[model samples]
Target: MDYNFLKSLHIIFVVSWFAGLFYLPRLLVYHVEAQEKDAQAREILSKQFEKMEKLLFNAIMIPAMFLTWITGLSMIYLTWWDSFGSHTWLHLKLCFVVGITIYHFVCRHLIRKFRASEFILTGGQLRLFNEIATILLVAVVFLVIAKNTFDMLMGMGGFIIFAIVIMAAVTIVKKIRSNA
Candidate 1:
């Protein structure tokens, strides 16, 4: 019932949620890449990834996201949303959370698509997609920690640049691996 307890739990679930957000996409990359193998090998690995993906979604990602919302909303309610509801920083952070929640469901859709061997996204595209979450995470974390003092415009610009760098690095790595 205490605010501090809810905050702590919220933090814990936030961490868990981000962990799943980070990893599930990576699993997708692996799953899609596995399709390049011979049919038998691809079947075996796809099945394995299917199990891992399901377990991660059901056991970790979904639950953690739910709890993160529960604990976070509890804190807001318990405090009467006094200082939070009107804050621009909180608004921006919540918008990012909303974006990622949509992203989470999109990932679920991707899982089903992949399960049925309907690969709309290539492995490299999926890698770039994963960076979207990373960029959102950076923005949300900075917003929460900086609050009113945060510079949203500057931070968002920086995140865009950071995401571009990450994608470029991934591209370089992929090229190197392919050329090797």
Candidate 2:
């Protein structure tokens, strides 16, 4: 396959994936904010989220995530296998990618629960989640730009993992609290 073609697809998918990530959380904000007492409003919110999830998950995120990894690995193989081990940027990117994957699954589960309308996180909780995501994304961008040594890359990766763990723990606690 043509390297350029894969590169193009990778970029497109990545942009789409990020779009979905940015917008999905915002949608969740609105969805959770809608009063359950207002049937029409609640319905509208639910419908909007469901629609977003379908497009974001099926059309954008899923495909992008796959293509991003595929193209990334392919590019690595085609161009950077020898350099990969020594490249700090690539190492950092891979670690963040793992973080992204974990967060992706967590988001998927959260969205599913939201679709089910089982519970709503408080605005504060949602905000916290948003902040965590934003910071991790910033770190990813930084690593992409900086591309330092493995030790530095691992430090950033560690921070990302910590952020993810905290987010996941908060979400689980919220779920338990809501159920209670």
Candidate 3:
């Protein structure tokens, strides 16, 4: 395969992986909220959501994650492995990737919990947890694209501030909903 073609495939898989990451948690939020409904409705929603989670995890997320890794490693071996080893930005990106990988499996565990009718996390808390992947995605993309041109200290500070802002927004929205 051509280099560009392989790279494009990798990008496609990465996007798919992210799509799973984003949507699966949202489904969990819905599943959790379903508890508020009557028993029959809650049972239907939980079963549907459980099936959706399994299909999304197996059909999309896992395959995409592996393909992304395969293409990524292939690209590194074919072209930039040595340069990657020397780059601070790549190192940061790898750390984020590892973090995302952990998040991926944690979500898988969450799917199992949902399937088993184990409602450990509340809907609001799951909503907060769902934002974690987005945060990591932002960090990885910024690290790669910005490279050394971006300020590390400033970026860290900004990320902390961003998390705070997100949390505050969620809380404010919750309060508004409750009052209304």
lDDT for each of the candidates? 0.89, 0.73, 0.89
Pairs of colliding residues, candidate 3: none
Task: Give per-residue lDDT, candidate 3, residue 117.
Answer: 87
Q: Number of clashes in model 2?
A: 0
Worst 10 residues of 1 by lDDT: 76-85
- Give all TM-scores, in the order shown: 0.93, 0.73, 0.94
Which consecutive 10 residues in model 3 have the weakest lDDT in total? Answer: 78-87
| Segments in model 3 whose C-alpha atoms lie over 4 Å from true places | none
Q: Measured by TM-score, how close is model 3 to the native structure? A: 0.94
Better of 2 and 3 by TM-score: 3
- Per-residue C-alpha lDDT of model 1 across residues 1-180, encoded as one tens digit per residue: 878888999999989988988999999999999999999999999999999999999999999999998887787677747776578877777888999999999999999999999998998889888888888888888887887787778888887888889889889987998899
Clashing residue pairs in candidate 1 are: none
* Count of residue pairs whose backbone atoms collide, per candidate: 0, 0, 0
